[model samples]
Target: MPAITVDDVLVLPRLPRLDPAATAYRPVRRLITAPSGYEGEGFPVRRAFAGVPMPELDPFIHLDQMGEVDYAPGEPKGTSWHPHRGFETVTYIIDGIFDHQDSNGGGGTITNGDTQWMTAGSGLLHIEAPPEHLVMSGGLFHGLQLWVNLPRVAKMSAPRYQDIRGKESALLTTPDGGALLRIIAGEIAGHRGPGSTHTPITITHVTVQPGAEVDLPWRADFNALVYVLGGKGTVGTERRPVHTGQLAVHGPGDALRFAADERQDSHTPQLDLYIMGGRPIREPLAHYGPFVMNTRDELIKAFEDYEAGRLGTVPAARVPHSHGQQPPR
Candidate 1:
């Protein structure tokens, strides 16, 4: 654990310049617009892809873009006690403080740029909300949460949590210094993220300057997609334009190419992107609300155990910080 510095971001490896003519994959499939919805105690959210079920995004079930809204004093709200099984919940905080407490005695505060990777294997009860102080004097609340499915064999394992600091993530700038990528759970330009995963996944927070270019490579077998956080950009060779609050579902490709358009508003001279991909689980999912299992019978058993007090309760006490074990490099 040497000290991480800004120089670390500036001197990272550059993306490979693959031959455009020899490229094997670059197909923009469909675009998904996440409709607005409310979750928990009326917390605003936008449900991205997999709100229904697209097996192509297997190993990855759901994506929710939480508030980028300015919360008035006492207006902040969040999820109450809930149980999850058969998969992991990945929370990446962007603009506010999110507090968490779980039955396994796992809890922490996720502030700007921090990430909380929780494996809700077996079963566990947890609650997430704005920190009490923030709830009292409300500010901005914004982040993204993704559900990563586990294999049937690993679904019933004991639960665990990973609290990774913002600085722990690999922050990289493009060779021309026009694009920036914060790698939270995957590799980009030879820089690896801090968060560990049971499945093969890559989650990068990208920001590109107007007219700038950023290229990212991924395994051909992995399902790659991008969620536009702000501004606008063109993706892949198709040059399909995607704007804020839209999900670009990309087809099988060896790499991802994105650029912010120069002919955009001066108020928005940059584009923010959340690019993700992973090895598909390729298994049938019996999903119901918060529980995802291989069979309906197992799904029923989950509810039975939860109702029988098998899954623990949210703590009365606040555990401000519960650091998790680092995955081996």
Candidate 2:
């Protein structure tokens, strides 16, 4: 069979009309400042909620802020072959390009604003690396990869992949056109995201124009948090100010209000925020590097499966595709 391209798996969610009567929800949870770490051969990464064992943050296991770093020519870095099981990987590229290939005959290039959702159900071996051109002439690399866990019943399901084009995302502008919200996995302003998820989750990328404010609503059952990608801003009813590289873990509330620093600064552009949450699975978690299962026995079985080559293999038809081909806007 020919390799399955991203276009084949891309699915758009039906956009919904906004409910004008929707009540406002403010963030009230504890704040968590993600710590910096390294992954994929010294590539810098910020470990968010998953690094810490917070039962409040379930289903959503780990979130990594990948390189916002500028690299010189020949300094490009990335992850080689690795294995994963029992979770879904959501990779969102903000600046540069990422080339990925997996054991299930899934491979593709994701550039600025694109997202790749890979479900490592049962097991899978994958490689996430930079394209050769980028390695030859480096530039700024910025993106985020989040790991979403599967329920016990779905843990051993067949692996699947979906590459969502940025343009397919539902974009909504504030009434005054001062801010924009990019919905990737949930409804915002009644516009739905592009992802088909086993777990109920919401991932929204917000751009707050200088001196402008925006409000977003999330389900009361979903545990929510906001991660600052750039500039500084106040989040929640308390207006707790959070800056770049900081994560604001919201308390129970139905809606979140984000206001960029009111004092406009041409040098600062605007505030970049990523708000994500989902209904907690509330199950026992046995996690090891690259594996997350309900029990240690299950995790052991996963490793055994991968070792025995139970996970399917990438088809021999792995032809390389050019990168930087942004989806049609």
Candidate 3:
């Protein structure tokens, strides 16, 4: 990995740039806004992709909602115990408090500016909820849930967890005074994040100021995408506008240049974007609901083992709804 320095920050390369124009920005194919009891009124959760619907985005599957909510104090609504196999789930919290407990006897709380990484290698059971005080006091709650697929060789590896505090992650402030880049997995500018991952991937959270521009390098062989969390900005040479809750899919390109229009006063002279890419796995992906495996027979066996009580070994905790939830057809 080559490191680039800008203003005392170090950024490293995980992959070369692929063509960004190969694929245009596609609107979120599917969206799910599920209400969470923990967050006040309407807590919209949008499901970008999941399971068999979109097998793998080069080792990635789902990019759920970019949530922004206000939780009334003391509310207890949060995600309950669930099972996952052969993949990883990443929770990035932008604001508020997120507390979690897993069957591995691991439990902890993550406040604003924190990230939780969980690898459900073979299988694991877990539950996530907001903190009681924040939920009742009415505070902003925002975050994202991303699902990354594991290679067949690593699918059955032991489950694990990584909790990264926001202030501890790598940060790179662009020279043009327009972008604040957070290196979550790979490297950006001249900064590298602290989280260890299983694939060759780069995940960045970027904020571009109005009329500011920054060039991002990526590998040509890796697949990539840019997700707009808030505001509007232009990617590459496309002079189009992108708003919140929308994702822009870029083909293989060497470098990504982002620019926000300088004339719009109503538009917050800033753009929030999540830039992610990874080496695509050229393997067959067989998926059903929450479990992603290599074959349908494996999926069937997974179900049988769960029913027979053998698949619950990793997370020792049993979810009440596990038996009743059927595999997706």
Winning candidate number (lDDT): 1
Q: Write candidate 2's Cα lDDT for 152-189 as tens digits.
A: 88888898999998888777666566666778897664
List per-candidate RMSD values in Å. Answer: 5.7, 7.3, 6.5
Supply candidate 1's per-residue lDDT for 265.
65
lDDT of 1 by residue, 206-284 (tens): 8887898776777787888899877888988778888888888888778888899986666445788888888888887
Better of 1 and 3 by lDDT: 1
Give the runs in model 1 whose Cα sits over 4 Å from its true position.
1-12, 50-53, 263-269, 318-329
Global lDDT of each candidate? 0.79, 0.77, 0.65
Q: Estimate the TM-score of every prediction.
A: 0.91, 0.87, 0.79
lDDT value, candidate 3, whole model: 0.65
**What lDDT score is found at residue 200 in candidate 1?**
83
Q: Comparing candidate 1 with candidate 3, which one achieves the higher TM-score? A: 1
Candidate 2 global Cα RMSD: 7.3
Report clash pairs, candidate 2.
25-255, 26-255, 28-251, 29-250, 29-251
After aligning candidate 1 to the native by TM-score, how far in Å is the CA of 52 from where it should be? 6.6
Poorest 10 consecutive residues by lDDT, candidate 2: 1-10
Which pairs, if any, clash in model 1?
none
